[model samples]
Target chain A: MSRLKVLLPSARHLVTEELARGVVERYDEAAVGEHTVDFERRLDLGGFDDAVSAVMASHDAGDLSMDGAMAEAVHRQLRLSRREAADPGIWRYLAIVHRPEVVRHRWEYRSFATMRTRFWRHGTRFDANAFSRWWWVAELTVMAEDYSLTHRALGSSALSTHLFSRQLAWHHPTVAACVRILADAPGADVERTLRVLGKMLGLRVAEAMGREELEGLVRAARG
Target chain B: MDDFGTDGLTGGEDEDGTHFRALCKDTLFSNKREEGAGGSYGLGKSVLWIFSSFSTVLFRSTLLETQGLGNPRLIGRTELGSHALGPKRAFQGPGWFGEETKQRRGTRAESVWGPAAAEISGALGFQARNDHDTGTSICVVGFKDPTADADLGPVELARATRAALAEYFWPSMALPTRALTARTEAAGQEVEVRPHDADVAPFVTAWESYLRGEVPAKAPLTKPGDMTVVEVPITIPRTHGGEPEVKGRVALVVRLAAKSSEPRAGQVAFFRGPGMVVSYRDRSRLALGMRPFHAVLACGRGRWPRKPTESDLAVESFLRMSEPPAHDRWEPTPRLKAHYRRGYAKALTELSRRVDEALKELLIATHVMGERGPERLQRRFPIGKAGSPGKGRSAFGMSGLDARPQDGAWSFSGAIERKAGEGPWSVQVRLAEVDEAGRRTEEVAIEALSVTVDAEVVVEGSVASVTVPADVRVVPFRGTSAPCSFTGALELELAGRMVAG
Candidate 1:
């Protein structure tokens, strides 16, 4: 049986935000709200716990950076489908109730404001919560079955931010194509290209485009 | 009802006339209340008129604030839904009762005072209280119950009122400091409603235990009256307007009910520091095999165990402002938004989340507390790492040596390599989709494909099969994934089966 379940009404709202802000304050206790049971499958917390511990130890042990590693670890252990990855609540439960210590250890307790957004927030805010941010970066950049591209997309914080910030980059194939451009055009202004491309993608529906058309747009932006 | 009436309704008084005007006005005109006062919104006073079928209510009070005018004061107010007193004359709505005034230029109506007020109060069958005691007596001329049949006798009304008071005000009735004492009269027989009454006992015990510090944090609740407290966090955000972020907590008080059919079971009463029950949340459906229980989600300064800090006060303010006009729920209200920034809405959800989360802890069985997820859920999800490329992935075959999107299709080209003394193998490749719920969609059609290899290829709905001759040292292969439109993310599932050498 899966020990993990997704919080329904999948958006950021009251119970979700309270769970977020109170994540550190009431980290050990489960949130008081409705959650999926039999209809929505549960997740196993054991392997996830192990993965989280490995990341935390690695970060504390120094050397091998754990951002991408944790991203890979969570992605591998969680194995959430693309749709499950989109729900900010699961990331909230994962970070807050499931493994808040890792979030605190990784993100650090800056302030309650940071804690609020890092746990849960309203609107198209996948970037705020610590777990969702990394999970999404991996999801958008990983090729067919390879996470190597995912590692490269997260190679540097700046590179990851530039790619992650763009709406077009949220489209998996478009980001995969853009990430390849980042690897190819070594000296190019990757940030400027992606930013300009994001504005353009915002004007158009990027999801409807295939990889070839998206790559063409990425190459055009390189000019 | 027993004593203490310092503030009284004063007429013809300039400075403290709010008491008189607000009580006998068109609608409740009093919106201002000092922080942590036992009243709010002023909408509560209207309940007297609402419960009265005559739309009329009479108030008689002994004076302390208005002692200069006289000893006792009597007044009446009615709120009628615009009706015709006679055939031609129409009355807009509200009207007052007391004395006809010649000095006041506006409405001739005014509160009656002194010996006449006392005589009239007695004639109206009002309960007699000590003359020196300062308080107001409100008589709703003909009380109404929308759900009840016609008119209930005084005894039934008294019994129902007692039960309600016990259910909602058990904490106040049980307090060690003596917050309030209530008595109900039925059929000319008066009975004191104690905290130990059937409807009130469980909650009273919870409050008594909590106040006595018998059950604090994480205490086990084994028997009846045993309780536990969980502090749920409510953090208010800082805005561009420069209010610094404030962090606070709402203490969740949960008590184990004595039996399954207890009236308040699976219900939670939420209140603030003012010590009044604000609302009751029904959680009956959420309770599973857990013990039947009632809970109290106490917030603000009044409910704080010790002296409240600055942050605690801020939390109280946050919650108070968030309350709607009904004051029954803590949600993002216009007043709350006007005071705080836009993002404070999360606090409401946080509160709701805490209520359920706290219940999950208290109501669910202790055995299931540490129990992990359901059976066989630990297996790797099929998309990400299931058929994913990995180190020491001894699934012997050149499946996806290189894979990329080519000409709007997934192009997979790899050579089939096997060591000497190895058998010929059959390779299977399938394209699958993940549904909205993160589960893989059932395998559909994948035959709209292009296959290029020096071997025979067979196509099934979502799977592709290829057989390679054992003699070939290495066979180069290339193929396009699909022409079938798949909406969600797709993953390629690959498998290899050894034939014979």
Candidate 2:
């Protein structure tokens, strides 16, 4: 398994002109390599571009209907190919150098200040990077060869938001999968169902249950 | 909020206050104007709406009417995502926070919250201005947690707000007028925002000095060195007709330190009218020898309109045609390109030339060149001798040369010698060869015979010897000549002054 380490900013300061200028001037690809934990598995720029283009095409064609699933698949595929090079620095490089145009295209309508954060920072928080969120959501929710369920869950905003935003809820894949299955059922009110499950599961239940037990709990919540 | 008490929330009724309308609505590109004075794009004001959890903000303004009477107004507006309420019903999210006004001549009736202006103002702790006071105040309701990390309550949000105000509007604070003052209420204590604090003292000082038409002697993060200031003239071509020329000045500060801690040292900030910094150019790309330096250029206010009229707007629009939407960078328009060529580029080149000259003079005055004298000489004059010949034979029977059975066989040697009481000097000997056609074809170096000469003596023999100096470097011959060949007669000539034995 490839582990990507991300360094959060020491302080949550606004990105100023001086800060932006400093970051731009000091950024060096070689320096990034030196700091990377996996130096040997550096991402090939051409391959990254090709993968990005393919994902963007699928996004534009509406083939990737579930934003959550699309985010997951892109993250999983990109990470799987270059497992060793999975680091926050690489993601930053990708956001700033490789595909800033695509990010801007998707998010220019929002405030410029908000857009700056999406393009600069990384993590799994509310204002974490737009790209990192997709990668992380996919990494946590999708099991081996069961991306279809992840897609269905992501299509429902209630399930996906709860899964992605709450760290404890999504860490247990069985519980997450059961929630997705219940949300996908006919005549199910996803928002209310998620609210109830959220209260019942809490943090302790999420921590304690394995796949089978979590699935049973999810069924009991449904009942 | 208490410092300028009694001043109304609005500047005045007669003043052009429509600029604040952009802030009231969540409209994209609403403030695009021909002139750069107004908002380039309306997205900047959206930060206020984004900060509110409900995407709502309240505006309260007390204005002086035509009769100089105080008229306070309050309004609430929100911008929610589409389909937030339901699929069919969408809220416009605008409401007056006071009683509705009755219809009058040339005006329609409007609905407002049912409360007296004074009551509302007092209830919200918005100090009501006396008859003379006029200004504006906005309250963003239900502020979202601005913290990027864990939720830290309202204190973190207050700090973030103060920091943002300080960083983005430091230039405004540095102005003589002190254009804006921000205060925050956290933990029941109001704290004033002071962007001109010690952390950014250099920028503050530079800005103040720039406004006073004086460039500081030192750059932001460099020790004092040679500083040069020059005035550059700029001409803005009017879109409609006339051309206005503005005088700008460029100040270059050479740092005393060899390395600079300030990353912005080599950048030149370009200020527009009223000493407002619009953008910066990295003039370090000029390949100037002086790396630890900073330059600043400011255009006089005479170039821009003090209060924009229609005609002035045309000029401003024309002047800023090439400016980006954020006004953070200058794009290349034909007019701007011409201005750059005439003003910016010329000033930078001249400053760089002066810096180069000053650095060279400093190096020479400090005797730094003496340390590199030997290396300089070695590079300029390579220590070697050259000859053109097919072959040569040693007359003294030296090891590597065949002893030619000829009438005239010549050999020469040259070396650089340093005497104890004299500077280093070069000594060389050359022998010329003459062919049957009576033309000199080649020259060869002959070996000098070793001999100890206690006094000046002309030694005539097959083996010529010179006394060896304490430290001497023989100049090796660098010529493509064969070891054994005799073409013509050989004549020996020795050059350079001889040292006393």
Candidate 3:
């Protein structure tokens, strides 16, 4: 009788249980010709790549402006070529793990994309990813539907780095809009606006503001 | 780490070799300008090479003869080591010893150089036309990691370069601003910069306009208007609902209005507290009791449509009186109840509204801030929420499991109480363990255990007390057992007090 070997995952290996199971279930003895074949080839990384590809693909169809915004961010933060850096599809592969709980959950699956999403969902885990220039553009630049706000949010360095680092940024929805409006101001005006807004908002204003209020702030910021 | 000697000067010494070597040098070569010197003396460039093994300089200076043309230069040298058998050792590397005196400037140029430089430059966007006049531009050679570079996975090289720039540069680089300017282009918009300093005129003008509009000799929001004097009952939330459901009330006039000149329109004030007035100004952030004014205003607002509720009145009046006025007029060492009457009441009402928001933000930020260094935790332990107690000790000098002061020296202990999830609580307990020299034991529990990081364990069987004899050395004695000797043993037990009333 032949002995079956169990493969242990890597320390950096990130995936959720559901994703890993979905990926594993897709493979069968007949379909998976050889045991040595790469698992990614046989199954989707639990729609990780699909999700990323879909997001990037939509930039042209959804909001070209958003694509431009993300590209600018890539150029600023990562200093990468805008054409290559603006792709939203690339984010799916990189997970933003905020907590030990998220890391634990990621290890349960084999899909990198699932890990990335779960990581990105939490503020703590999601924030560090934003500090990394390349990943930051990919994370904040990619929008769910409306790319205009997201693009504008990405273009402003103060909005992206300083404002986002503030206590209020957890109010991401608000943060996204605030940057958009402020992005239009001259460098001096933008700085002044941000400083004033910062002072008025004080600390933890985002959390204090209602979802509606945050959206209002965002609208105000886009001026 | 050993990826050395992969530069252009592969062959030997020639005028071309000298020129090529000069090109590979780390410094900007000649950046002596008349006005504001934009570039450094290649010192920063040298530091960049030391940290990250990259040897390339790109520049366009108005001070140098080569001002406009954005030329890429390769400048470096290969030095010999005394320990080596041969004259020259296997590439001891570029910019290894210090600043390379002989610099060779490269003649390569790229079109995007001007725009790229302009984006980061806070000053004039001088195009590179190679006229050795002034300014500077340098690019450290980058490592090609196909795997990471595939999608700009992580710009390790760029981060290192940024770090290098920050460390070596003397003056802080001001980021270019674009907030107040507008630029239009056929294809793409141009970036602009703005100053961060205050616009003095607008601030002063706004203040003057405000004063001129309403010279309200009677300070705005301070005077109590047609406030009906009536008593009302209130129910503080369960979260903040103290032992007494109904606290107390105060009968005072209340006023609410929308006015001109103010930043936040809605303003409420109280006149009966310790000070003459209490106000609550609603800014973007939560101002629970930021000032007595806010608390009074919130309390006044809460007790609307009817007379003031017991909780509202108590909190309103408490916050008014409890808040130490600006002039240090509020009596020092005021009774806790006197203070709590307002402080606690105000706290309850404010907590009712602000606690949840604070909690959410706190939790999210805590998770996001990432792992802080142990040193930071240690530093914060004395001043942060963790060090709430200790009778205002400020800093607990010892960093052991626990420590207590007595006799002359501070004592250490292994006995600790770790609650389920509370923290490694710090207790002021006398040690069963001995002092530096051999000695007997002494028992003392100076203060109650204060939990910091988490709830701690109640090491059930390990709890023991020792009596330290005055004259004996404090060191652990071998072959000799110290009998348990204390008023009580360390254990987790419920007291008669109940937190929830």
Candidate 4:
């Protein structure tokens, strides 16, 4: 498999009044394709849409468990085929062109200034891009072959957004598992716990900690 | 932190204490110039009353004795309203929480309440100073929670308060001798807020740099008058005849560029007299194509009349002309807006021109000395076909390059055109090295060249032609080892016709 080569538009074109105005207009797939740099081995847009449909269906059916499972599935699929879809512009194109209705539905109440930001590449915050955040969160928190833990961890919206967007290390599966355990603990104040964890992570003490050590740290932190 | 102390809230105080009543009243005050005499609008203090859950503030003061030697008078007052009750039951909020005396009569007698001020001050952990000390302090009782919905903890609230004070009062704080001092107490530690503090260092730095003329200076207008001016010529339609000339001074200060998510990188802060900012217009409105730059256009104090007449009120500097109730912005009336727009248009145009010139100079300096510097230098010079005289067209085709700097190497590229059934063309690249001012300093010939054409060469009795090929390296310069300072233009001659890139 070859990496996707997405060319960036000039900086001037990004902030043009036309682009700002176009964000609210109906999606034009052809215009998006014209602006996007062509490359071989693109992500399977059909399959991606099917996955999104399945997730939205689950959400409609009130089956809350499907949220993290869907995120994990999408991440696993994209990471296998065209892992370079992680690049911001590719995801931006997917959100704005491939599934703009979903973007609008999710951010209907947001101001135009905020709605426009959902289409751009902001620093570090995966949630800044509506579609990429799901993949990134799953990639960061999912234990190998057991997405049950990912679901439990992502149960708390604040915890999931903060961990995936700002704080968590994707490479440390043990830390992810420990945080998942802490998140699912009965009556856990996930927001406060994440805030504490965020502060501790800044101090770099958890870098060498194993799963057991991290569990102990979480327990002590709660105390 | 130590109580370095301040001049205190002395807006209405005098050494003789004759006008001390001004401090106790809550009414709109304006001077002859119609500018805020003691305090602007006199409604700012009401924010405390509104923010106090009990609608009361315990005001304490130690006044300096002006006459015979006597103990300084310490007084306390509270102002409240009984709006819930009938008018007959309504009570004036004022109450004297001080020593009882026969002299406290009339309104003072009617309003005075509570025990001696010293006892109350001591109970509240407030210091009661003697004759030597003279300043006022207030303890807001039942203070309302300002950030009720913000969910901010004590630490967050402290940080936010520090930042807010820094941003709003930075101009006053930046002065060498400030009229007031502000401090914040958090976690039992008091920290003084200053202009150079972490929260507001950038604003302070920009302000200081502006004062020192390290940033761009305000351009002066040519018109003869006592008023300083920086006129920008504009072509707005005039009712009388030709375009009416609008004049103004615009001072600009450029700051480091900020990312989109960060706070605004640039703005134009308009001010009236006393350097109070009336409005802050963001850079997005100006649409200047340069990096973040701040501009200021303050109406001269002399422009405002001492007593506002009809004509005086029409002037842009008149206090009531454009100021909103909050005094935070200038939303001019239609007539005043027209005059303001004329002046503002001129100021912005002038600022944009200066920014463009500065950027060009910076680009030349950076490109000349940066890595891969020779390649980067090409973007500055114009590219065109040779023998086209004057200057060549820029990349965007907006304007031609004024003069290429003579401190860097030049690179040129062009194609060899062969007329059908005519002949194959021979090409030579020429170099002209100019001095710092772009005057032809030396005409240097190409020491080495690598030329490749799209077609095969055929010379039959000086009439040659070849079919263009798929792969060709047309007029490639195989790395020049010449000295880097060889600055000038490179011209490509195809079939004895000069072409430029």
Best by lDDT: 1
**What tens digits encode model 3's per-residue C-alpha lDDT throughout A1-223?**
1111111123123334533344433222232232222222232233333433444455543232433443333333333243433332222223322112212322344455644444333232323322233234444445654445555755554555455445444455556656646666566665545444443343224666776776565444333
**Model 4 in CAPRI terms: which quality?**
incorrect
The segments of candidate 2 whose C-alpha lies over 4 angstroms from its true place after superposition are: A1-223, B1-38, B64-69, B80-96, B102-115, B125-133, B145-153, B179-181, B187-192, B195-199, B213-228, B233-235, B238-259, B274-291, B300-321, B332-501
Question: Per-residue alpha-carbon lDDT of model 1 for B112-209, expressed as tens digits?
Answer: 88878888888987777665677677788877876787777777777777777766666665655544444445455667666586665666677677
Q: Write one digit per residue (lDDT tens) for candidate 1, span A1-223.
A: 3377554544344334344434434433334345433225656679978877877886863222567787787777778787767766677666655665665666544466666676664222333777887777677666666788778777655567666654555567776787777754443487667655654453346678887888887777666
Sort by lDDT, best first: what order? 1, 2, 4, 3
Candidate 2, residue B48: how far the Cα is off, in Å: 2.1
Whole-model Cα lDDT per candidate? 0.63, 0.45, 0.31, 0.44
**Model 4: lDDT of residue A101:** 51
Worst 10 residues of 2 chain B by lDDT: B363-372
TM-score of every candidate's chain A: 0.72, 0.62, 0.36, 0.73
Candidate 4 local lDDT, B236-267, one digit each (tens): 22212333433333333434434323344455
Mind giving the per-residue lDDT tens digits that candidate 2 earns over B251-328? 332322234466455555554443345655554545423444444443333122244344434334433545555666
Per-residue error (Å), model 2, residue B146: 7.2
- TM, every model: 0.47, 0.39, 0.19, 0.40
lDDT of 2: 0.45
lDDT of 4 at B215: 46
Task: Look at candidate 4 and tell me the lDDT of residue B207.
Answer: 56
Native-contact fraction for each model?
A: 0.00, 0.00, 0.00, 0.00
